[model samples]
Target chain A: MSGKEALLEVDGLKKHFKVNQGWIASLMESFGSGEPDYVHAVDGVSFELREGETLGLAGESGCGKTTTGMSLVKLHEPTAGDIIYDDQRLSEATDAEIKKFRQNAQMIFQDPFESLNPRMTVYDTVAEPLRIHDIPNETARVQRALEFAELLPAEHYFDQYPHELSGGQRQRVAIARALVLDPDFIVADEPVSMLDVSLRAGVLSLLDRMTDEFGLSVVYISHDLSLLRHMCDRLAIMYMGKIVEKGPTDQIIENPQHPYTQALINAVPVPDPGVGRDRVELQGEVGDVIDIPTGCRFKNRCSEYIGDVCDQVVPPLEQKTEFEQDVACHLYESAAGYDPYEEMSGSPSAAETGDGAESTPADD
Target chain B: MSQLEVEDLEVYYETEEGPAQAVDGVSFELEEGENLGIVGESGCGKTTLAKAIIGILPDAGYINNGSINFKGDDLTEMSGPERRRLKWEEISMIAQSAMNSLDPVYTIREQIVEAIETHRPGTGRVESDEIVTEMFELVGLDPERADDYPHQFSGGMRQRAMIAMALALEPSLMLADEPTTALDVIMQDQILKRMGSIQEEINSSMLVITHDVSVVAETCDRVIVMYAGKIAEEGPVEEIFNRPYHPYTIGLKRAFPNIRKSSQDLLSIAGYPPELVDPPQGCRFAARCPMATDKCREEEPEAHYENGLRSYCHYADEIDTELRPYADDSDTWSQTAAATDGGVEE
Candidate 1:
């Protein structure tokens, strides 16, 4: 419930890593190879982040949630599409404009141990950002950031390395570094997942405070749904390099539209033993991003597989509920004329058993 | 006699400063065909306990004093070879990291067959092959991939292969130490479900050690909540989740957000767990616990029993009246911890 102004507008964002490389690929290219392969890590994902609104990217491992977050912060240059941030196109921005954007946006990595340099002291880690941005009063700024991160008596930690600090303290240092520049937004990828449960809440609450105090828009990328539900205002479920569902956090959690989203929600183990949840056992693992399915990426594992429509036509993400929820499933139609579901009783064995058999339709 | 009984187990890891009392004076019993979970945070010694039971402690670690009685046989008293003989035949372990646990050089089939042949000498190759195939099918893995090396398999598949190997012998006791920690949530759920069915099929008791409370709640019939290398609470899963008596348990339960409940504040237990090396003489959790007092810091607490529940706390009797209410509030812990700090200063 923040301002209507879109702080970041991402349209058709795509990042593909070349699978065919090295001497072999060069030789093939010399002979005029037919086509090179690519792993579609973040393929055609689009979302708008309203100012000060926290958006969560939820999915299993290799679902491109991390890739999407990395792409947004320009950690991975996009192969296609546009990233409009604060009315400035990042892909086409000049050197000065790009530097300004870099100062305004920050990213907190998943592993505090790996992300923070072991050799760098806590003081230098926080001050390095300010120094890079050419901001003055580095010591004072770093001190304020550390204090804001709840590392009291900041001067005491200036000399200490990451190894000297506990997992919680290391994460606090990372948060301090991320917020040292006082960025407009932060892309925190599994920030607290590495910390202990006791320490997790402290770091999370600190994040909550940052958002409230600074009105910082945060993009939280995590597989833990419960954590996301607690921290995020909106939820986007990614499956096979695409957003399968996007909606308000509560609405998506309570009433998931996409079958993949439903499976993900059901799979999260509830802490309360009394609530006996009916387990939605989705068959098969997440599809390979390299050889993505032609139509619905989730058709291989979806328990509610309809028919040939899922095998031939890719489902467009559209408004399928009364609330502001968009789901990419043939089960929900954007128009009234065509019904995607012809039969639901037959087993999806044809879809399951065959790989790259796009020619054979399950049903017309 | 129980299927397995650990009495006064004390495992210490040698460090430069002193011996870290990783698992100090811990005792628990597992009945035949029962699922028992040991839940705690990192460095609380849950992993150490599991490692000690399996007789796979590192060279630096040793059992100071304890008895591990399996089927009325003392494993702790047994020699290294004697304990090695019991491995895979009596008590098998599913280690935390599948990638690390699985042998990368050998094929999956070869490794499993080697395990079978080692434990059951004179076992024919054809029979071992059948066993590997059956185990693979049982764990929802393709039998054709048996020849594939561990490096070729995905994380989930590798874990399943581990389960297949662990259950190949059909050991009476199965010790899974954080089996699903490295996998995705959906993959974790699938693996847990598969483990459940396989356990039922084989009729083996499982000892799941994990820091995830929700995973424990789902898979365990009974749970032991460990803190600073001691059991803070032990009871039926329902009792632990619904009505915990120990302040640490209450704090732990509150730390995890209930997916079913709409937006609620998560209360992190203030302060870290006490240093295991030369730990304080009083209650180990007194510093972080909300109901901690001067007595808690001065004297150790004995086990207080209520029905089938066992809580290690000074104010266990007055949990409902005193501890439970304050444990949920974030401010209560901070205030109590601050007051305790002041008292320490005084």
Candidate 2:
């Protein structure tokens, strides 16, 4: 349905925000020439959305996937980067062009319970999009969207407010609002993360069908790997405001090149009891995003850190020989000087917990 | 004797509409040093059950019936002070979120030491410090960061601190309510696995409650499936996962996507669980059950034994082997949902 055309091309995207400084500190900044603090929410990310492809931004919490997803919809304007959609540059577009872009792209927020307006009924919630865009036949378009979103029969829900609807129903209504304008693209941030497991599948299948039928490009952002596997064709693994790896979903999961991606894949709890994975426990918490790391963002928690080069030189996103996915790590780079895994490195204490605890069942 | 036992437990919240029966006639037991898990989704009364056991029910809530026994003593019948005396000394609980559980005003050390001192009164400062350090080591936390405030620690560390506080007294019974729910997957694996090791070291009975099936399957010895304030199935973890007899358990197991498997369409349960307010007199899951017969909607099934497992289904033996295969398809559930709509539609 997409005809393999590039709909949105994002290059070197960066989003940074100034940290709140105390009044005294702000006064001191006038005299002191020290650099003011800034949180690099999204340092640099590059990706392309084919006309109808689903690109999954996968990572743990605070990894900046949400910020990147919100940026495309102009929720968090990028401090530096180029955003070109449908051959039109979005970063420096005219007022009319930006307005048109907003119409074509819409966002489905994370929490269904909080995202919807408490006072608005289903009709008002879905119809608001049409009204804002000044679209004709508001009733017909809203009704069609409600039906397309699988809020079946449509009329019963039109009179009901968000509080009356269940979590699944509320999520469906949110989707309808996004689709009311017949948008060409969607940025869904953890669309089903808040819903129950039973309801998750229903909402996912709805999104899947809508994307396929409408030929819509989607930036589906989620920390859940399983959901991404089911929903997306390609995935970009983020770490501290950077896409450390990006490739086909299957290839990335099957043979993840980056250490962080490998850890994430291994960490996903398998539902079955029979399957056993050699668990990799990260050493400590994620580093403070405010104090971004110099080199690879994941190096502090990385198990197989190469050497001083890992601390000195930042690794570019490079495709290694063994993996089909692109990776940014010194281990894959030959210029890193040496392989640490080949030598003795792991602390006996960390290894003791990693190996001994998994096999030794708690019960006698 | 079992370490912990609950029989005919019923808890109700006094709401404006009426008393919301959150936990209704739920019965289960945990053996000495055994790990048990209560699995359910939102509004299934797992946490209410925990609060009942901990004797921490809110002002508006009360236990209408049944007894919670901790080592032969009826906890429900005990006086307020008697129950308070047993709080961390005999039984301990790791609350849902570690960050919220810890007081932000105090250091982690102060909070832990205070808990230890409150129950066990008057351990010398040096001894208390040593014990705190040992507890930190047991949970893989560095003892040097003991003086750091709650904000200084990570999510996993705060959880570990909470565990250290809970385990400070080495209680015979430990209850962890969604201990790893909010943590990242990597952090969850380590924390849970570390908890298993700690449980083994302490040799304490554990009751873990969570919405994730995998958490129970991997950690607990026995599992109980709950729906609409009633037990759906109860058995050993392996048996329950491999051969689920209850329709609710079958639907739940199939709903979650397997990480190892190829990308296939997920099978979701069609309808939500029944509301507890004036719940109907029938199988709580009958409305959503795929093979729900007319009898299922009319009569509540008792726990019937099948190969040592207990299933609350009239046709447990019949559905055990048959419904397992059909549960993979979403259509099977949707069709039944459509078929049983007109009667007790609420």
Candidate 3:
């Protein structure tokens, strides 16, 4: 997976939203030397999407998966960091370069119901992208894209409005619109989450075909591990505006290093009833991105909280295992010798469970 | 006798076009302390069936023909006040959308106390507060935060509060409509785990309606697969997961990608469900069933029983030999369009 050329590179990407303080509150805050509040949605996140690779961006809601995807597509402009596509820096790109980048990369939104215009016909929706790019041969391109989406004949659906199509068909129209530009990559944010289970497979298979046949790099964002496992070649797990762990799909799912990743995987309800997974009880819900603590954001809910170290130092994502994945946690000290974490002990729950690794903590 | 016996349940919604047959000729029994899950896609009438049982269907919707016998008393036959009296005390529902269900103005404790006091007016504030605390504890919410408004709590917390409210009076039968649909995987798991423990403690029968089959696979004891507002199959959860006799059940099972397995090809049931207002005069699943024949398109299948598993399909008895061979293949399902076209009279 690493051998392929990088299609899109996101480095230290940060997107923050200002919490609106009323005039009275703003005046009160101005009187004091207090910092203005900002929801640190996507903070210090970095990842690379190789050509022809399908990378799954997975996290619970508000964990910045959607924010990161939006940032990549310039839907949400980043406050910090950089997004480079096809060797051109997006932030510093010329108008022409940016326009070309837009044609190169597209986004398939989560909800098909709201994504497409109700008034626009299927042909018009698919043709809009081509018209915007000022690409010629609009008639042939739109029909071909629809055919590629398996909307069968494409002409049959030319006049049908979004309201006329089913959830699956509407999504296919969304897909055709995304693929009409013939982009190098597309960011699909929970593309099938709204569709029925029966229809999800069809849409997903179309995405699979896009990557395999067209060699299109895709950043597939979803909360479902099951769907991600089937679709993604590599998986990146996010928590509270940062990539906690990212590795090969199988490696991450089978042997997750981060406590948050473990809990997330264990929590997924397996379809097979016979295989009973012991519940990993983490204390609280996801912490607020606003006024985030100095150290690990996940420490409050992390079962494997290893004392003050987790609360004191922000962990950097690095190669924790022999595998290609990188994990961000205080437990896996990147230094060769003199582990500071070895001295401090974990909480009672961590010691009792002690399934994370052999080197976590031992009773003397 | 069973705790809740629903017989020949036929529910319809008065639409602009005509009466939409949301639930048609569905019958099932929920025994004491049994966890029955109704799994299907949107428009399958699982939610409508739940709403009907709980007697909270929308204004347009009504029970066309059915008998909802709860505790030897038919719920459909009861008057407005009589049914209202029975709600929180005996039967409760955990609505699909937790946020919408909880009133934003009232505090969690106040809302719960109101339900308790309304059902049993003699209960004092202190007693009701104690019940609220106990219920909150059972649902894993901090009892101290009971005074907080619905907006003060997170999505998961609000859902827990909803669960706490539903279990406040300790209803004999609990109806949870997609309890964890809006929640994330971790929150969903925690909520489900909490519900399971609470059910064990209270010994209540729960009817869980969800579009996700995996939720049913874990939480439910018996499962009913609904298609086009009709029962396509009914059996134990394990049997439904392992050996689904109905073609719809088979297709539905294959649709879900298992977390345990790697790179499994997900096969979708091609084509949309028939229009509910005027569904075809045959098996509702015939259009999408790969094993569907001309006989299937002409007539509705009778329920075939095999070791407690009841399947509504022509080849239910010979499912293993005939349908199983072609079920897993995506191509088999894709060809269903052509097969159905051949059967359709133009």
User: In terms of DockQ, which candidate is stronger, 1 or 3?
Assistant: 3
TM-score of 3: 0.94
lDDT of 3 by residue, B1-346 (tens): 8999999999999999999999999999999999999999899999999889888899999999989999999999999999999887899999878889999999998999999999998999999999999998898998999999999998899999999999999999999999999999999999999999999999999999999889999999999999998999999999999888898988889899999898787887777788999999889988787777899999999999986899999888788676677776778876775444333221
In terms of docking quality, model 2 is: acceptable
Candidate lDDT scores, in order, read: 0.86, 0.83, 0.88
Off by over 4 Å in 1: A20-22, A321-323, A335-364, B336-346
Candidate 2 clashes between residue pairs 3 or more apart in a chain or in different chains: none
TM-score of 1: 0.94
By DockQ, the best candidate is: 3
Best by lDDT: 3
DockQ pick, better of 1 and 2? 1
Candidate 2 residue-wise lDDT, A1-364, digit = tens: 4577888998878787788898889888989867677777777788888888888999888888998998888877777777898788887799888888899989999999999999999999999978877899988888899888777678777889888888888999999999988888999999998999877877888888877899988899998887788788889999888889999988888788788998999988877776678788777777876766555677788999876556544566656666577777767743334342322244434332322211211110
DockQ of each two-chain model: 0.56, 0.49, 0.62
Give per-residue CA lDDT, model 1, range A97-206, as digits (tens). 98898888899998988999998999999999888889999989999998898787688889998888888788889999999998989999999898899778878988
Model 1: how far residue B120 lies from native, Å: 1.9
Please report, as a residue range, the 10-residue window in candidate 2 chain A with the lowest summed lDDT. Answer: A355-364
Off by over 4 Å in 3: A1-3, A27-33, A321-323, A335-364, B337-346
Instruction: Report residue A105 deviation for candidate 1 (angstroms).
Output: 0.7
Sort order, lDDT high to low = 3, 1, 2
